[model samples]
Target: MDVEDDNSYETSTLQVLELKTGDSLRDAIGLLYEKNVFGAPIADVIDSATTSGNFLDPYIGFIDFATMVLWSLEIGELAKSFLWDPFFPVHLNDTLFHVLLLLSKHRIQFVPVIEQFSSKVIAFVTQNAVIQLLLQSSGLEWFDSIADKPLSEFRFENDEHAVHLYGDQSIAEAMHILWENRIGAVAVVRRETERLIGCVTRSDLHLLLDNDDIFNNRKSLTVEKFIHLEASKVHSDPTIEGDLGALLSAGILTLKNKFLPRMDSPVTNRRTDTLKQTMKNLAETNCSSSFIVDELQRLKGVVTLRDMIVQFAPPCMDSRINGGGFFDSALEQTGCHIEKGTLVSDH
Candidate 1:
């Protein structure tokens, strides 16, 4: 899709998902899950058609799971406090190549496409959405070059160590790590063996918030308890239980209950796993990240959506992109690099 082309990625302003300032937290959660979108632009007015005019703040900044999760920790309602991030905005006149550069090279998660002066948001180009485009390019010369290579072939920026926790760690502790690092999820392992058992994500945090007692007593609960509390929902609630078996098991999870992600194993990939393999597992399981492990499944490193998207990114012509060094002569084959697009500076 050419970003400069008016017809590409076009949708009426009416079709845009906009959360208002006055919506209840519960209502906001229900809408995000119901719409199945990563996030939505926020309008200051109750049913405002126009959002974030000439400024991306309070609109795209008030995004999905991360925005809401961070917001919940602060107060009873959404405020301007949690709206800051590294996201950059691209105008409709920007090239698709430009969007790709930000998604891949800059490792930016969301690039809002908006009108030039008004800053009226058109839509978001995200890493997940872009990666899906790359997947569809299977068998293409450029995509296959990297797709077929093992994950070990690429050097990740912080492949050094993945943030993780033992099952016994308090839920409050887990939330602290996620909030401070601004990461979505962390690997959960067994205390004695350090073997991967499950994970807790920002998305999962909402579950605890759903229950008044759970939310208030989070400091007292272990991560294991939090995960089990989530698993228990599958057993008791039929509404949210479609294909959740991949998320939790029907069998007991621990000495207390039966679950090890799926009563058998956690979702993971090996160093030898291909990029394509990990992408498939992520899409199939609806998981945000893949825990890399040894044959014994001891947690090693984590492959996040950001890591996966960067792998398929084309080499940038602009020397200014943070990681200027790209793979091989792939740069010659790819062109139309820009120094930078119109970015929304985080306030």
Candidate 2:
């Protein structure tokens, strides 16, 4: 597409959630959860002393939902903490290329769009939004053409390895692993076989919001017990008391309970699979990454959306090296394929 000339695409108004400096972190997190967003722009608190009195004039930073969770756990009170600072925001006049560069360089999910002087957040752009636009406009065939490449080429060995959790591991341990690795999810493997059973994610931890006691006692309880209790409570059709009874009957109340049932089926792909197929799976499932497996179903590597973006960047750079002629060629290719009867002409 003619990204530069088509300013219309870049200037479209986008409605986004904005967080104030003084807003409670818990309330902000709740708003994110309710809206199913990962983060929001953090606007500066209004300064009453200022003569302009423009509330949107200063944006300090952005707060990620995951960061909020970590802070909440640390302070023991979400209300005590304020939004984190030093966030990156994109300018309204910036081209899509600039946004792509920002997303790829920072490895962030979304970036806020702000006006030049006002610093007011007009909208936000997400990796998903950009990918969707590319797919709809250019189709996936080009991406699919590159899919036959092995995933190993894209794997980052210097980054932390995939951390797995045992069913009997404590929730505190799981949280620590997540925090240390700075990852949102981890594989839950069978203790004896080391085989993947299920997966646990930050969202799964949302179950803790339902019970203050459980949230408080997270350290003592095993993941197995927590999963069972959550499942029984959420899935059971009986009364709340009956659900508690079921939880007790399932032998999950005691710390000695060793039952470790799977929570959610793991999303995985073999290392032998083509990148094209993997990308297709990721798009269709709307997952951030897929576990790379070996012939024996052993966990080997991980292919994340960031990795894919990194891989695709070089080719895009190559296309742009010709001083914007690639878009003209693409447009020519598209025009040549138009049907005879569909052509419009001035009579």
* Runs off by more than 4 Å, candidate 2: 1-15, 30-37, 48-57, 75-86, 91-93, 115-119, 133-145, 157-160, 224-263, 314-347
Clashing pairs in 1: 54-118, 252-257, 252-258, 252-259, 253-257, 253-258, 253-259, 254-257
lDDT of 2 by residue, 1-347 (tens): 32333322342334666888777877887887676555677776666776564545567777776667766775568565463645677775566666556666565665666767676766555554454444444335555444456665445432235678887787777777776787756776668866665666655555566578877888998776665564442322223322233232222111122222225545678766766666655544444566776766566656676555554442233332221223323434566322332322222
TM-score for candidate 2: 0.66
Candidate 1 vs. true structure, TM-score: 0.68
lDDT of each: 0.60, 0.57
Top candidate, metric TM-score: 1
Scored by lDDT, the top model is: 1
**Predicted candidate 1 versus true structure: per-residue lDDT over 19-79, tens digit per residue:** 7766766677667655544466666652346553434344534456555765676465655
User: Which stretches in model 1 have alpha-carbon errors above 4 Å?
Assistant: 3-38, 42-60, 71-83, 90-95, 105-107, 113-119, 232-266, 314-328, 332-347
Deviation in Å, model 2, residue 332 alpha carbon: 25
